[model samples]
Target: MNTTLQQAFGNIDIYLFDQLLKGRFDSCRNVLDAGCGGGRNLLYFLQNGFEVYGVDLHEQAIQNVQHLAQQLAPQLPPDYFQVAPVEDMPFPDNTFDLVICSAVLHFARDEAHFDAMVRSLWRVLAPGGYLLARLASTIGIEDRVESLGRGRYYLPDGSERYLVDEQTLLSYTQELGGELFEPIKTTNVQNLRCMTTWCAQKL
Candidate 1:
């Protein structure tokens, strides 16, 4: 990758990059990264004049993101990046035009924890806003994952993750009064693991 491109988008999720190419968030102003880690997914948003906010459970991660934000968007207040958990964000309801939870939901310890985190993300999104997420799932390699009970699974990749399926995502979309902005797509990595992209728009 070219240095300029790398600087513009620092290791951003490729699926999220696809949304940018489609101008899915062109009208968005306020953006929140629910589980931002060193703001890897935030460089483009910050440099492009988006009002960016981020939260992470790790204090050091928040500090790192704040530092990155300072370098990329000095005008933003330091409080824009905070130390918090996805299940309990500090922002008000319907606060952001775009809420990103990439590669984060799969860390849920169980079904309840996952539901709490999902609801919290949804609660902060404005009506008609977008929620973009990429998380591990048992989509194409169901048989390759061993159930640990309560939505947790041990996968062939030698890791444990709380995996969701197509039906689970669809159910949440319906229950949250959201619509799928893009059909759920999953990438199976050599039968070791799978990651699914879930893009939805709040109604």
Candidate 2:
């Protein structure tokens, strides 16, 4: 395997990188990074010939990703990136083969917000597509979080964030008629915060 192309994947989440190693995305030609921030998780996809698209609420973030696309995959159209909130995406239904929502769903204002974002992403995923999300969760350290109400919590890291647990994720997966492609795995960051990697295939 040629690895020189992968070195450009700077600081990507380890769990996501693991999926890349497993060839989970090899058959998916169209990809979306729902809350792509500066395209850190997309370098390999762009350089390796996948039709990459991205959306971010911040216009600057979209611009940065567009710049990256231009430099790495100049053959793509400029409109492949957009500035839009994840709660409601502009794309039509079943638009992508793979959707990535890394470190983004944790910013949801409440349960409603989280669902809206997730649904929007799901609505754009074609049947048999995949959704991969990494978000802050209270799974392992439930007692360590202080509920701030409305699905938000003050984590041990002194930050207030919207967190989910295993049950919530599993319920959503079922409600969406999706099946887990991998087990729900959470990483505990020295009791400060926990991040869960949830990967599922839309049925």
- For every model shown, what is its TM-score relative to the native structure? 0.98, 0.96
lDDT of 2 by residue, 82-117 (tens): 998987787899889999999999999998999899
- Estimate the lDDT of model 1: 0.96
Candidate 2's C-alpha runs over 4 A off are 1-6
Spell out the clash pairs found in candidate 2.
Answer: none
Can you tell me which runs of candidate 1 are displaced by over 4 Å?
A: none
- Deviation of model 1 at 202, angstroms: 0.1
Lowest-scoring 10 consecutive residues by lDDT in candidate 1?
1-10
Task: Report every candidate's CA lDDT.
Answer: 0.96, 0.92
Best lDDT among the predictions, by candidate number:
1
* Model 1 agreement with the true structure over 61-156: per-residue lDDT tens digits: 999999998998999999999998999999999989999999899999999999999999999999999999999999999888999999999999
